[model samples]
Target: MAEVDTEINGYIVPKNSQIFVNKWTIGRDSNIWSNPDSFDPERFLKREIDIRGQGFDLIPSGSGKRMCPGFPLATRMVPLMVETMIHNFNWKPKKGMKPEEVDVSEKFGVALQKAVPLKAIPIKL
Candidate 1:
C-alpha cells in the first residue's frame, strides 16, 4: 500500500495550489516531447518508453493502480483493429493527397479524436 501511496502523491496537486493542472497536458508537454506538435509515432518506437498511462513520460491513459482498466482493452484492440485493416487490404490517400497531408489534428473530449475524420482508400487486395 505504501508503494501505491507514494506514486499517488507524486502525481497529486499541492493542497494550496489554486491552478488546476491536467495530467494529460503534462504527458504531452512540449518541453518533454521533441517536436511535440508533430505526430511522430517513430519517436516512441525508437525509445523503450511506453505510454500505457505510466512512467510519467507518457500517460495517455494514466498511471498507478487508479489508472484506467480500459487501457489494457484499448492496448489490445487498437493494434488488432489496425492489423485487421491492413491484413484485409491496402491503404492509400486520395489522388491529390499524400499520407502526410492526411490531417492528423486532434480534438480533445472525454475521448480524444481527430478534428476531421480520417479519409483513406482501403483497396481490397
Candidate 2:
C-alpha cells in the first residue's frame, strides 16, 4: 500500500492504495532481458543481478526474506534431478519434427503453462 500520495513513472499513487506487481511482464521485459520471449537458460550466465537470496524474488521457489520453507531441500534436489536426467538420456523432439519446429509457446494465466504439452523422447545413454 502507498504511504502517501505520490507518482510512480508519471502515474499518481494515492496513499494507502494497494499495489500489485506483474511478475509476468517484468520477466518478459525487453529492457531487462534481451530476446526475453525466447527460452535461453544461458542468459543468466551473461549478467549478474541481485534477484536471489532475499534480495529480489524472481523465478521459481523463493528467495531471501520471502524464501519458501522448502528452499533448502529444493535447492539441493532440483539440480540433482536436472543433472540426473541429462546424464542418463538425450532428449529429442518427436520423430518427423525438427527441433526448431517444436512449439515453445506459453499460455499465460495465473501461471504460465505450455500451450502444447512438450513431447520429447528420452533416449537412454
Candidate 3:
C-alpha cells in the first residue's frame, strides 16, 4: 500500500491504496528494451541486470517481502532435476510436432503458463 498521496510518472496514487504492476508490459516496453517482443536471449549478455530484486528489469520471483520463499531451493534443484531426466531418458516432442511447431503462446490467469503444454515422449535409456 502507498504510504502517502504520491504522484508517480504523472499518475496520482492515493494514500494507503494498493498498487499492482503489470510485469508483462514492462517486459515488452520498447523504451526499455530493444525489439522487446522478439526472442533474443542474447540481450542478457549485452547488459548486467540482477534478477533478485536489485534491478527492476527482471524479478520473476519478486524481491524483498514478496520474494518467493523457494527461490533458493528451486534455483538449485531445477537444473539438477533436468539433468537427471536428460541422463535417464531420450526425449522427443509429441508425435507430428516439429521443434519450431511447439506453441509458445502464454495463458494469462492466476499464474502464467503455456497455452498448450509441451507433450514429450521420454524413452528410458
Candidate 4:
C-alpha cells in the first residue's frame, strides 16, 4: 500500500499536497456501486453496512479515526427526525407519481441537495 501510494504520489496527492479529494466521484463510482446514479435506499436496507464512516463502502459522514465527531449525533438525529415525520404524517407525491419515478438529481455545494426540492404531500396521520 505504501509503495502504491509512493508510485502514484505525483498523479494523486496526500491531504497536504496540491491534489484534493473529489468526494463526488468517490461516492458515485460505478465500480463500487451497483447503480451509482440511482437513489435506491433499499440497496442499503438488508446489508450489514451503515453510514457510520467505518465502512467506506457507505460512509455518509466519512471514515477513519479522524472522521466526523458529530457522527453519533447525526446518527441519533437522522432516524429521530425521520421517525417523527413518519409518525406524524404520511408523505406522498403531488399526483400520479411513484417513489421510483421521483427524480434524484443533485446540486453540489458545501453539501449536496436535490436540484429540485422533493415536492411531496404530507397528510396528518
Candidate 5:
C-alpha cells in the first residue's frame, strides 16, 4: 500500500493503493538484459550483481524490508543441496528422451515452474 499519493511518469497514483511490481517482466525486458529470452548463467560470471535485492535487475528473493527472511538460509542450503545431489547420483533424462528435446516452457502460478514436469532417472554413484 502506498503511504501517500504519488505521481509516476506523469500518472497520478492515489494514496494507500496497492502496488504490484512485476519483477519477472522486468527481468525479461530486452533493454535490461542481453538476449533476454535465452538461458545464460554465464552472463553474471564477469559482472558483480547482488541478488539480495540491492541490484534492481535481479531480485529473485526480493529486496529491502519486505525481502524474504529465508534468503540467507536458502543461499547456503540450495547450493549445498545441489552439490550433494550432483555428487551422489548421475542424472539422465528418461530413456529414449534426448537432452535437447526436454521441454523448457514455463507454467506461471505462485511461482514459475516447468510447463511439463521434468522426468529424469538418477542412478546412485
Candidate 6:
C-alpha cells in the first residue's frame, strides 16, 4: 500500500492503494533479456551487472530501502554452502539414472520449485 498519493506514468495513484509489481513479467520480457526463458548464469559473468539492487536487470534479493536485510548474509552463505557441498561429496543421480535424465522443470507459484523432486546419491569424499 502506498503511503502517499503519486503519479506514475501519467496515472494518478491514490494514497493507500495497493500496487502489484509483476516481477516475473519484468524478468522474462524479451526487450530486456535475450533468450529470456533460458537459464544462463554465465551471462552475468560476461556482463558488468550488479545484483544488490543497483542493476535493474536483476534484483533477486530486491533493491532500494525496501530490499531484504538478510541479502548480504544469504548471498555469502548460499555460495559457501554450495561450494562446501560440491567439494565434500561426489553427487550422482539415483536409481542408475544419468545426469541428463534429471528433470529441471519448474513448478511456479509463490516460489519456483522443481516439478519433480531430485534424488541424488551423495558419496562422501
Candidate 5: worst-modelled 10 consecutive residues by lDDT: 104-113
- Candidate 3, residues 22-125, lDDT tens digits: the string is 77787778988999877787998999978777788877777788788898898889989999999999988899998777777788776566989999999999
RMSD (Å) of each candidate, 1 decimal: 12.8, 12.3, 11.5, 12.4, 11.6, 11.8
Candidate 6 TM-score, true structure as reference: 0.70
Give the CA lDDT, 0 to 100, for residue 40 in model 1: 79
What lDDT tens digits, residue by residue, belong to model 1 across residues 1-125? Answer: 13222224467544444443377677578888888777877888777777765477777777766578898799999999999999999989989998989987768766566999999999999
**Comparison by TM-score, 5 against 6, better one:** 5
Q: Predictions ranked by lDDT, top down?
A: 5, 3, 6, 1, 2, 4
lDDT computed for candidate 2: 0.74
Candidate closest to the true structure, highest TM-score: 5
Candidate 6 C-alpha lDDT tens digits along 1-125: 56788898999999978566666777778998889877776867777877788877777777888688999899899999999999999999998898777776767677456989999999999
Better of 1 and 5 by TM-score: 5
Whole-model lDDT values for every prediction: 0.74, 0.74, 0.82, 0.73, 0.86, 0.81
Clashing pairs in 2: 54-64
Off by over 4 Å in 4: 1-15, 95-98, 111-125
Identify the runs in model 6 with alpha carbons over 4 angstroms from their true place: 1-4, 96-101, 111-125
Clashing pairs in 4: none
Candidate with more favorable, higher TM-score: 1 or 3: 3
Off by over 4 Å in 1: 1-21, 111-125
Total clashing residue pairs per candidate?
1, 1, 0, 0, 0, 0
Which digits, one per residue and each the tens of the lDDT, describe model 4 over residues 1-125? Answer: 23334336366533444343566787788988888887777977766776776566666676776568988898899999999999999999879999778887878767455989989999999
